[model samples]
Target chain A: MNNQFKKGVLDLCVLTILKKGDSYGYDVADTLSGKIQVSDGTVYPILRKLASDGLVSTYLKESQNGPPRKYYHLTDEGAKKLEADKQEWDVFTKAVREILEDEDK
Target chain B: MTKKEYLDKLTKELGSMSYNDVKDILSDIEDHFTVGISAGKTEEDIANDLGDPKALAADYKEGMDLPKILEKKTVNEKKPKAPEPTSATVCFCVLITVFVAIPAFFSLLAVVLTIVLSEIAVALGGIALLAFFWTFGPFKATGLLGGLALIALAVFGYALSYFAVKYFVLGTKWYIAFIRKTWHEGL
Candidate 1:
């Protein structure tokens, strides 16, 4: 699979996860790292990107032990884009899957 | 490797990004590990899941396009430039432009009028320049030129503010201080 395909999906996956509800930066990294391996410190840069572009808003919430944890909430803009990206991705992936299956035949 | 060793490796690899950016990203990774541990994953388990620090840092090194990553750091790099021209700069600029340029452009008056108002503005500006020096016009301790320029402005401003005040009024504080010292000595 194209690495671009994987990379594109990582952002969409992040937006998708946030679409359900807000989550802290670490939680998003951990959950996504389980399904697809990311680097030791990759998720943060993505979170910062999404945030600086106005796709997310971060707020500090009290943590169990240490300092207040920053939580990333998907903005309305992010949610709308996630819906659109979901449509585009599904169509794009389905077409690619069909092409691969035809090659198998 | 320990977390500090891992972060040091990341910092070494990502020399292009600011160190604070690298530090924030490292904190995010540490957060990932902490959350993973809470969820019943071992240190090794979490570490394995986080593929490679160098490769990940490369994903964020401005604009690195690989097979699967968007790597759009430059796309977000302009956020830090917002605080450069703060309010003090704006006010100081307005003060200088209004005070300096308008006075310097008085060429339309007849010979006598031109000499008089031009002399007045120039003379007053020159005196203000002196006071501007005495007051340490700008607060820049590190900027020699800026400090000097602002000191020039400070004199200009003082001349502009108190240009017409009589020498008697200006010396009142000195008189009071001298009287206090003499009277205290007499007592």
Candidate 2:
């Protein structure tokens, strides 16, 4: 995978995870890297940027195993942003796919 | 690398960010390690999977720098430097400084001098009255009483004068010290 393409979708991918449910950074990373070849640490900075941009808000929740864990949840604005990003990604990937698949035609 | 060593390296590479921000980042890293450990992964595997701390730090730096760039741009656009102080402005500043200082100095000097002179006059008057009562006998029988009262008044006056002089001397010393300190450092 091209690093540029991964970097480009990382934000959307992160927002997508939060769009599903409020999850901690580790779970988000796990869910994300399961499909994409993302470095485990990359998700953290993405989460931080998302939070700073008001796309997500974080809170501390006690874990059964250890101390409190930070949980990130999407805000209303974040949901809106996720929708917008989803639309943009759809259009972009569709266009790219059609162009790439043109050879089959 | 072990989780602790990896986290410490990451923290060090992050460098000089806000405490809360650094803590947040470190917690995220810790969370990753914890989840990895729970998933039966080794510390080395998790650390290796995270890639370089320096590169991770650069990603954070990029995100942090975005708003900062926009802020700097807006500030630069909004603010224009005022014209440099002209010689006329410098002259006016000096004039105002002297205008305020000269009258203030003279008034303070006049007040202190008046206090000292009045105290000296009171002392002199008390001594002269005592001497007159002792030498010339208006009432010889009451001479002792009058003399004692005058002597007490003279002592009180002298005490007041002594205090005034001491206060003036100490004030001048403090003023000199303050001025010297400010000169060496700045106002």
Candidate 3:
């Protein structure tokens, strides 16, 4: 996939993954990269950006493993951003699909 | 590449970024490696899956630069330069202080002094009456009562003078502060 295209939607994908539930940094990376063809490291910068933008907040929670994990939670601001970005994504993909179908004819 | 090798490269690639930002990014990547190892992945495989350190650092720098610039702008806007006092303001303050404030202050001081002096005179008169009665062969009861009454009145007068002097000094201080503020900030 083109790097530019992936870069644009990567934020949306991460937000969608977080909408499912609060998850740790590694889990978020795993979930996102499992489906998308991206480097596992991609999600960290996106998470940091989202957090700094006040869309998400993080806290350390004790895990059954060796140490506490940093979990990211969707703030009200994050949820609102997800809703808006989802709508925009839907319209954009639909328009692109239509353009491809027209070209097929 | 091992986790250490990957992190060192990323840190070098993130050149000129703030220390805290670099630390936070490194910690996040470190956590990823720790979890990957626990999940049955080798260090080499995990490092490979994380992609190039240089590219990752570039993404972070891209996202951060704009916000950092905006943050500085907001901080600058928060404290605008305070206006300096104009020559007219200085002239106005000086003229008012010399002509109006000084004369009023002196008149108030004179009034306070008069009250104090009168209180002292009343007290001295009371003492002199008591002494005159004491020296006489027969001390009159009416004279004794008058002396005690004069002394009580002087005591009350002295209390009133004390309050007057206190308020006069306080009012002058308050006026000076008000003028100084006005001189700097305008009326």
Candidate 4:
């Protein structure tokens, strides 16, 4: 897969994951890497970028076995962005699929 | 490498970034190693999966730079927006300038004058470099030296132009993104 393709959608993917539930850095990276062929470290920069962009906010939560872990939650601003991007992605993929399927007819 | 060693290398690679930025990035990497260890993954395995520290540092730097670039208002933004020009507003401003604002006129002139003079200086410097290449060299082969100088100048100019266009496009894209962000933030 093209790294450029991954880079374009990485922020959305991270946002979607956070939209599902608050998650720590490692778990987020792990979950994404499970489904996609990304480097395990790629998600951190995306998370930081999302945080800096006011799309997500971070807070420390105490874990049972270790020190407090940083967890990311989608901000209200992030929720709106996620909705917008999701709509855009849906429209984009629908158009692409139409173009691809038209060749068969 | 051990987790400590990996984090240390990453920390050093991130030198002179704000203490908080460096701390945040390092802590994230540290968390990866910690979680990997608990999940029965070796430090070496986790580090390998993460790839190069230098490459990761560059990504982090880019993320860190994004906010700085977006928040930076240029000199153009600082200049007051001129009011919509009606005939009455234009005549009143002209009268004010002619009668009451001689110093303001000269200050505006000073700004334009500096810009025009610097532009002339740059043009002259380029012309001078093109005209008198042989004077700098005590070499016997003045023709060969001048030819070499011209080639070097061409290459430098080409590289500069290429980079200038590249950066200009990147800046314009960033500006567009900043504008979109402002619209979204308004909501």
Candidate 5:
């Protein structure tokens, strides 16, 4: 996939994942890697974007691992935006797929 | 850099920004990290998700704009990005005159003056070279010729110094013009 296209989708993917539950940085990296072949570093910038836009809030939770882990919780605004985005993505991808498939015939 | 390290470096580099803006950027970064971690990602993995640092920085720069950055560069900030070229040239010329050129010129003149004065005191420096070979040392043609040569060299040295002062003055003028041109172009 083109890197730019992948980036455009990245923030949406991150927000969609966060819709599941509050998560720390490490755990989020692992989960996203399983679903998509992507660089692990990309998540931080997305998280930065969401937080900057007031889409999420975070707090530090004591971790058994090494340092205190920061946990991110989705704000109400984030949840509403995520819902709209997922709806749009479903229609957009399905339409694109239909067009490409019809071209094969 | 890792996610934590990236944020730290950015914070340090952007020390001049308002605390609130920095805090907002940090919180957003933390949120992204938290989301990634909850998905079971490693710190490196999470950092990778952010994409290239330079590209990200450029995006931030585009959004904030350099004018905004300069606005933040207050008078308190060290070296307030210099004034216009003409003004800068004037300042530079002034500084050079006071610190370097003036001292250099005076010292040079002093040395030349000392040589001239000493030559006058001894009287044998320049004028003695024209001495006659018919006196007590009539057979010492080589010695008399050497003395004349020495006198010629001393006079030549003093004349060279006069040109030095002239060049120094010309330099200050060029410096001022160069400064003004640079400033005008920038404006």
Candidate 6:
């Protein structure tokens, strides 16, 4: 995938993941990088940006082993944004797919 | 690259960012490394998967809106935000201005006006004496000398009044500025 393409949707992806449930930085990075061809380091900046934007709120929870983990929770604002952005993404991808299929025929 | 090497590069690449911002970024990365290591990944493996330190720093700089943050910091440094004066401070300033400063200023103003009026009267008196010098028939010499002396005294008085008025105006300006400063920043 193009770096710019991945960067553009990275925020949406991170927000969707947080929408599922609260997760820490490392967990979000692992989950995102598992599916996307991106560096594990990329998620931190996105998480930071989201937190700063008030889309996500973070709180530290004690882990079973090691220091407290900073878990990110999706705020109401973030959920609303995710709903709109997801709809836009679906519409955009469907159009692109139809165009590509037409070319193949 | 090892964790230490990765973090050092990231920190170096994040040059000129605020200390708190840099510290926060470094700590986050450090936490990532710690988690990765616990998850059975070697430092080198984790560092490679995280990609280039420079690129990661660039992403952080971009994502954090560095330009806006840096601009805000520089503006704050250039001109520290003035603290709002409390109600008590406003009351104190008002009281002082009304009871102390206003009265003092008016008194001084009256004194300056008196000096000015006295100087003007003296100058006019000197002129009148000079104009009526011919009327001193027998005491012509006395009248001439007295008129010259009065004119000299009036000239000196005018100079003195000029300085007093100038200083009085300057003092009023200074007092106004002081009051404004006190209004914005208590005491």
Q: iRMS for all predictions?
A: 3.3, 1.3, 0.7, 1.1, 5.7, 0.8
Score candidate 1 by TM-score against the native.
0.51
* Per-residue lDDT of model 2, residues B1-187, tens digit only: 9999998988887776777878978878888888778878999999998889888887887788644633222224666654565565555555644785456556767777777677666666656666776788776547556656656776776677677668767866775575445444443
Each candidate: chain B TM-score? 0.31, 0.38, 0.55, 0.35, 0.37, 0.56
Model 4 lDDT tens row, B94-172: 5654775556546645655555555455545555655565555555366455555555665565555555556555755
In candidate 2, the residue pairs with backbone N, CA or C atoms under 3 Å apart (3 or more residues apart, or in different chains) clash, namely: none
Model 3 ranges off by over 4 Å: B66-187
- Counted clashes in each candidate structure: 12, 0, 0, 0, 42, 0
lDDT of residue A74 for candidate 6: 99
Tell me the deviation in Å of residue A102 in model 5: 2.1
Q: For candidate 6, write residues A1-105 as lDDT tens digits.
A: 898788779999999999899999989999999999899999988999999999999999998889998889999999999999999999999999999999999
Candidate 5 residue-wise lDDT, B1-187, digit = tens: 5777877765665555567766866765666666656657776765666655545544454345446645334346676565556765567656766898677767866766676665554446545555644354755677577667767776775666566556656765775675456555542
Better-scoring candidate (TM-score), 4 or 5? 4
Better of 3 and 5 by TM-score: 3
Query: How would you encode candidate 5's per-residue C-alpha lDDT over A52-101 as one tens digit per residue?
Result: 68888888888764457777789999999888888988899999999999
**lDDT (CA) for every model shown?**
0.65, 0.79, 0.89, 0.77, 0.67, 0.89
Question: Over the stretch A1-105, how does candidate 2's per-residue lDDT look in tens digits?
Answer: 899988889999999888889999878877888899978788888888989999999999998887778899999999999899889999999999999899778
B56-147: candidate 3 lDDT, tens digit per residue = 88788888864564322222466666689888888899999999999999999999999999999999989888778867747667678878
How big is the RMSD of model 2? Answer: 10.2
lDDT of 6 at B32: 92
Between candidates 2 and 6, the lDDT winner: 6
Model 5 root mean square deviation, Cα atoms: 11.8
Q: Give the Cα error of residue A94 in candidate 6, in Å.
A: 1.0
* Stretches of model 1 off by over 4 angstroms after superposition: A37-40, B36-45, B62-187
| Candidate 5 chain A: 10-residue stretch with minimal lDDT | A39-48
Put down candidate 6 lDDT per residue, B33-93, tens digits, no spaces: 8898899999999999998998888888888776664532332466677888899889988
DockQ of 2: 0.51
Comparison by lDDT, 5 against 6, better one: 6
Off-target runs (Cα >4 Å) in candidate 5 are B1-187
